[model samples]
Target: MFLSGFYGHQAAVVRGPKQPFLMETIRVDPPKKMEVRIKILYTSICHTDLRAWKGENEAQRAYPRILGHEAVGLVESVGEGVTDLKAGDHVIPIFNGECGHCPYCTTKTTNLCQTYRVNPFKSVMENDGKCRFSTKDGEPIFHFLNTSTFTEYSVLDSACVVKIDPNSPLKKTSLLSCGVSTGVGAAWNAANVQAGSSVAIFGLGALGLAASEGARARGASKIIGGDINPGKFDKGKEMGMTHFVNPKDISKPVHQISIGKGGK
Candidate 1:
């Protein structure tokens, strides 16, 4: 149940790289200044989470870390100075947050927030360089990404949480927190793909599929996707990829397929 102070909750904790995720009772501290405590209802795994779980990067191997980002949750409570969100609000966790007042956030040319950009190495609250999660014995557990949804309750900076429609399907909207956003953002924001253009995507994973979908939404004439998996071609086609190139079958460089300077 939600309360005013330390909340005891269940969490999947990993003590070491490649170690099993042990479901344990963890003590979660209440939100700090400009932070909010969330009751995570739905969380999805992304490849980025896997990489950290496997300790592929030295920084991610920070033991006893709660590693997850893509999720939808309800605000359990709000901390001091938090105005945009409150208890009972449905929200999504954003690894890269926009502070709203930052010059980058104020300008239309970029979406990055000056103070709260996505930092994989960041494992503590911005207000104070410390964690809000701890083991039953009071051993501090590090955080993963900005949104550590592996636990039942996670404390996030107010900027990292975005309020969503109360009636929205959280299971579907959960995709927006990571892979889907990464892919769509690439096509729509980074590339600024113009209509009737040819788009070539190197990978056909969830990110690639979402990118193809975004390109399709923008009226791209051709969307060419390259991947080692032949099984993914059908799904890619369904997502608006018009052509598929198997790198295993192609003997020459894939980029020589006549992409214009304007192509993404």
Candidate 2:
């Protein structure tokens, strides 16, 4: 019912493939039902954002769009039916949201919500299949993923936001919104990495480094990092990795080496 208070804010907008981002003033609509408005305090650009920025896939392209996902912010306002959070709460926007009562969320097999799975093609709000951002002249701007944080202000489904302890550092906490979480979640949950177990990870970039950190936290005795670039070896060691394997230098695949087949 509250659709009257729209505030003007600046956002980086991309209109075409490989185009420069335009700084445009857009009006962000107040949250609708089960939504929340956030005043972004910190944001991080991820590889996913880079891919979307390139508009790599023609079919997935949506012009005049706001693209971002990893960020930390404060809850500016809560929409109808949002009782768990209030204004001034610290939060991080999650691209993959969980609608607590959904069948998938309730099952032990997975945590993917039935309706809020990450969809590159979904450029609108879940509540009304419409855009919450628009040009000052009223032209609609598309949203990227479920959480768009490339602006000073953003609106997202309440489920997409996780309230955190106000004491947490918003800048560092933003990592949990995407890259760090993706890697750690994979190593901890999907892989079920156990204490004292040996672990091998390929491609030691930010994601791999995060996985190494997770493995280290689990008491992994041997954290072997694999990457074509030797430059990452130093950083990998800093993350508790015990060894580095460059697949290009060896005749055998890194996986085969991990399995005990010696690589040259």
Candidate 3:
């Protein structure tokens, strides 16, 4: 039985790279096996999304596409053979997919699962080459990454969706699906930032600020943040950045100034 009553809805569509998004009414097919349909509640625009939109990611370009990876939504229905999740479940759609038995997934060393890999350049369901989304006249539109949350409704592989706390605030929780997680993970897991070490983050964006916070949590001796914008300094400092370096103000690289002039 289908819990989702709606079959087609309005979506922001990009016909080509560097093109403005056009609001169009599109159709979403029913979830296939191991797939789930979701009604997007909130989707945060990410820099990665912008990059894809601006045609920076030429290798991953899928025309007439919907680009979004950070989203929080409620499961409207589960497809055949889906047992772990159900209708009405609050969920976050992830770009990464885990098979649970793959070497990368089993080792816990990486989240890049081999079983459910997706070609962001190509727009089709990982299960099959067929597109689940289409124009009102039945013209196929490519799926962005794996979850096209720019649309009002979406269908995704079950492995690409994670159940979240039902009571969690959907607006803030959406950030966890992308940028926030990327920043925190880079600092804690990849960098392995140690206590009492000096940490320097190159930018004052979300990722850099998050890295500073991670370094502070690890008891770093100093956390320096470098950015061109002076307005971001205070917010950076609040997030544990000890010093702010403005590149435009100095003749040389901010690194030379922040880290000191010489080996001495």
Candidate 4:
């Protein structure tokens, strides 16, 4: 059942690798089954976004794409069979889609559902290999990772959206959609970090800081953060990092300093 309405939205699109983003007006069709139309509220740039823009990942992506994955938005409309969410709901767009029946999804050990593995480079909706966005001149616009958060409005698979607390602050909570959550989950789920153990995390960016917090939560005795720049040390310390290591200052491996022993 088509909602019988079509709309246009503005998006920052990368025409090709290393090219400046072009603001383009795109035609968006109504949501199909198990999809939702989102009115994007806020979106942020991530290192992955930069990598895609630089064509570092071009082999895994197509051109004329809108790049963004961290986003918070409002549900403008829902497609048929979208019962768990509806219009007026606030949500975060997840780059990873979860098909409940997939082996990975059912196992609960990982977020890599096989539904997206068939064509990792294709940015189309999971249910279809086509794009819902088009240039005014009828050119197809490839989505960036399934969640083109750089657009004013976006259509997403219901499996890629998670409804959040209505009263939660949108701007801050948006971090949970990507970077921060990835870091925390890496420490908890991926590493299965043990309590009272040492954790050495490289980089002092948002992810590293979030990992520090996760380590602290797990009762890590010593959390060491390594970065080339000491400017971020204070910020990392505030996030529960017990020590900081500037790799440039140390000729030896930073991990050795944290462990105070030779390689195992």
> How do the predictions measure up, each by TM-score?
0.90, 0.92, 0.89, 0.91
- Write model 3 residue lDDT over 73-93, tens digit each, in one string: 999888888999999999999
Candidate lDDT values, in order = 0.86, 0.88, 0.82, 0.83
Superior candidate under TM-score, 3 versus 4:
4
lDDT of 2 by residue, 1-264 (tens): 244547568999998889999999899999999999999999999999999999888888998999999999998888999999899999999989888788887886435688788788999999999999999888889999899899999999999999999999877999999999999988899888898788999999889999999999988877889889998999998998987788777566656655664532
lDDT of 1 by residue, 1-264 (tens): 235656468999989989999998889998888999999999999998899999988854688889999999999998888887879999999998888887898887335677788788888889899999998788999887788999899999998999999999988888889889899989999899999978889888889999999999998988988999889989998999877788778755545553532221
Model 3 residue 256 lDDT score: 65
Worst 10 residues of 1 by lDDT: 255-264
Please report, as a residue range, the 10-residue window in candidate 3 with the lowest summed lDDT: 255-264
**Top TM-score prediction, candidate number:** 2
Separate clash counts for every candidate: 0, 0, 1, 0
Off by over 4 Å in 2: 1-4, 251-264
Where does candidate 4 have its weakest 10-residue lDDT segment? 255-264
lDDT for predicted candidate 3 compared with the true structure: 0.82
Considering TM-score, where higher is better, how would the candidates rank from best to worst? 2, 4, 1, 3
